[model samples]
Target: MQITPDTLATLNNGFNAAFLQGFNAIGSQGNQYQQVCMEVSSSHRLENYGWMKDLPGVREWIGPRLINNLEATGYQIVNKDWEHTLGIKRPDIEDDILGVFTLAVQQQGDIVGRHPNELVFAQTLLKGFTTTGFDGQYFFDTDHIGYDVNGAETSWSNAGGGSGSPWFLLDLSRTFMRPLVFQMRRAPEFTPLVSPSDPNVFHMNEFLYGVYARYAAGFGFHQLAYGSKQTLDAAAYAAARTALGTQYRPDGSALAVRGTHLVVGPGNEAAARRILLAERDAAGATNIWQGTAEPLIVPQLG
Candidate 1:
């Protein structure tokens, strides 16, 4: 993405607010939270992923992304930064100590408040716009979507090659999961402390907050063009064009998929511009998807 003033302005204005809310919901530990943590025993796993070996068509199911709870807390503090400033300060100055205590309370909120942001960003950085086959795919209904008819490792796809992307027809819109679901706790609220005589100390009550969110960031229901193949060339651009028409759910139904969002890494800025800003197609034909999709340049997508 461009680091120019205008580019940065666009990013600041159009950053992912949905994802942000999924990460941080302030004052929510009492009743609202972005996500929650669910314990998984060795037997209780996060998800099941289907894979097939090229060697002998050996199929197997593997573990998918796991959710864990992390603890974040605000610190307790009471400060007398200007205790000796009685003459240097006003006589009826209780707001200084109380004000510092109030600020400390805000810090406490930030401590646990930022974990969801950190976790979500890390996950996105790791798997945004991936092209592998269900490498980290998670599904609400493993029985339907995540499950495949590979004969359970005893079965294999004899259809020439493994399944590629969905081959959907036009106008039939496909339904997709809302991307992420964060389960969180509303533990309690923060309380402050103040002593009348000893106005030097500020304190915040102890509390905890966390989430167990599911992140599914695979590229559509199937893979199209990605990796080095996604240059701004004819084939690469065709893959994107194809996705507009070819996207779908697993049931062989058309999603009538129309994408207005464009996700690209910093490296793809030039290429992305070439594709998104084209007045015509590569052969000077009428651009079909042009002016419809807006680019969301993400450095983490690199």
Candidate 2:
């Protein structure tokens, strides 16, 4: 499939995050350096394009790109220069560097999906090898099943799945265990604080305090686009409440929580706060804690 500029940018961003995380994780293991490099180099050669096959230098181009991206993202380089980073002396024998690269690419795929822009670029590099019938699938000897009904390897046929489908097939060897579900009771006195006259306040209050509310409901919180603060606050509050497991009855149907507060006009923080304070006092929520105005707290999963 053809890649668009936006898709490419998303791929790059995702790859950068994945690569940094992988590099940090593996590079911390001191003794497995050479093995790491070999795995990376082999994987890259298998997956990457032909121009990279036998470049005179020990360092691969993608290696530097991955490293640079990681470093830019505030990750510290655990190993020194690649030539001596893994305690290896021989140029041909060093595999730790390659190992790092391989881990980075795999992690990137997991986070951003397989067809990331970086993967696309790497595949494009493979065009030179493809001219010589060098398809990447055989670079690693995965397995060899016999021909299918069409006398072609079953592997060559369409798998009847699209992007995001699992490539391998295997059944779990044991029974899967299920987790316990906890049912929470609705608060008796809880009432929505938003009013129609100052809808911006509702959206803003939600944007500000809905973070904790969303977490209570079991979904993650994110920032709302800037607009009418009062309306946004009202909506945000309702959204956050719903996220926190509060059921809202509308036409006798319970709506699944979708956590985003829509605003009607330009958002004003000052006006939003004024409306929120008046509503909070009216609702008799004496324990309300006020903090410096900020859009959504930084999510800490832990």
Candidate 3:
């Protein structure tokens, strides 16, 4: 193809089409982050998660309605820039070997499409033991503070203490909130720098293409997720579920969180499947825990 305006435009259009094709293909089928994290749009470089605290439940109407204020928790998620670039040597297009470059660009789109899974599962959830949530405590901690029925400061936990491969039990029943946040400042855009006059095109003798995106992942409500490094056995799974269900709100009421998904790494996929799918246990006893929660195996977690 000649390096004319029309040809450059045509090349970009074709590459963009391929990019979308690849993106849509994987975005719909391979994304697991949406199962655990809620996507929230960000208009600025950083978003303050100050409103994560629970509000007081409605009480009997007193002389004046109790005005509960949402105090800032100082938890924030900052959107970070991300990009994946692919350079096609000028000779490739001139030689009509553009098919390979098209696939390469499409692959870049696939990478962008799956990036949220990396941020949520690989980075955030995998490191949840050390990562702080909105409550200014590690997302999965034993001493998460809450209030009791008497308005007394009480401690609750979302972590099951054990020294083994980490697994998570997430309460995704809430529609408006989740245990994790996916903050998107900008959707991915695929752009090309193929103009003949462009310095990079002239000097590098290649056409540059890239996908740019701005996003970040952070912990949301700690009550919605429980992480256990304990060997993912029947006892551990049951314990985690019980802990999540017994969480209380700051207003000293039942938060009523329930574990809806069982997240595990490749290392524990077999055990997780046995626990959730098997109709009978290893002892030939009925699998009472069957269908408790759906099993999600995240490759990145391994």
Model 2 RMSD in angstroms: 30.0
Cα lDDT tens digits for candidate 1, 1-302: 32345643433232223223333445444211122112111221123323211112322446763332332222111111111001111221222323443343344445435544334323422332231233232211112222123322221110111122111111112222222222222222322122223233322221112122232222222322222222444445455555344433333344344544444556666656666677787688876656655554543335
Can you give the lDDT of residue 121 in candidate 2?
19
Root-mean-square deviation of each candidate, in angstroms? 16.7, 30.0, 1.4
Q: How many backbone clashes does candidate 2 have?
A: 34
Q: Please, what is the whole-model Cα lDDT of each candidate in the order they appear?
A: 0.32, 0.23, 0.87
Better of 2 and 3 by TM-score: 3
Candidate 3 residue lDDT tens string, 176-283? 889999998999999998888888788989888988999999998888888999899999999998888876565677878889989998999999999999999999
lDDT of candidate model 2 versus the reference: 0.23
In model 2, what is the error at residue 122, expressed in angstroms?
24
User: Which digits, one per residue and each the tens of the lDDT, describe model 2 over residues 37-86?
Assistant: 11111211113222211111123566344322111212111111111011
Residue 120, candidate 3: alpha-carbon lDDT: 87
| Per-model TM-score on C-alpha atoms | 0.37, 0.16, 0.96
The segments of candidate 2 whose C-alpha lies over 4 angstroms from its true place after superposition are 1-96, 114-231, 235-282, 285-302
Candidate number that wins on lDDT, 1 or 3: 3
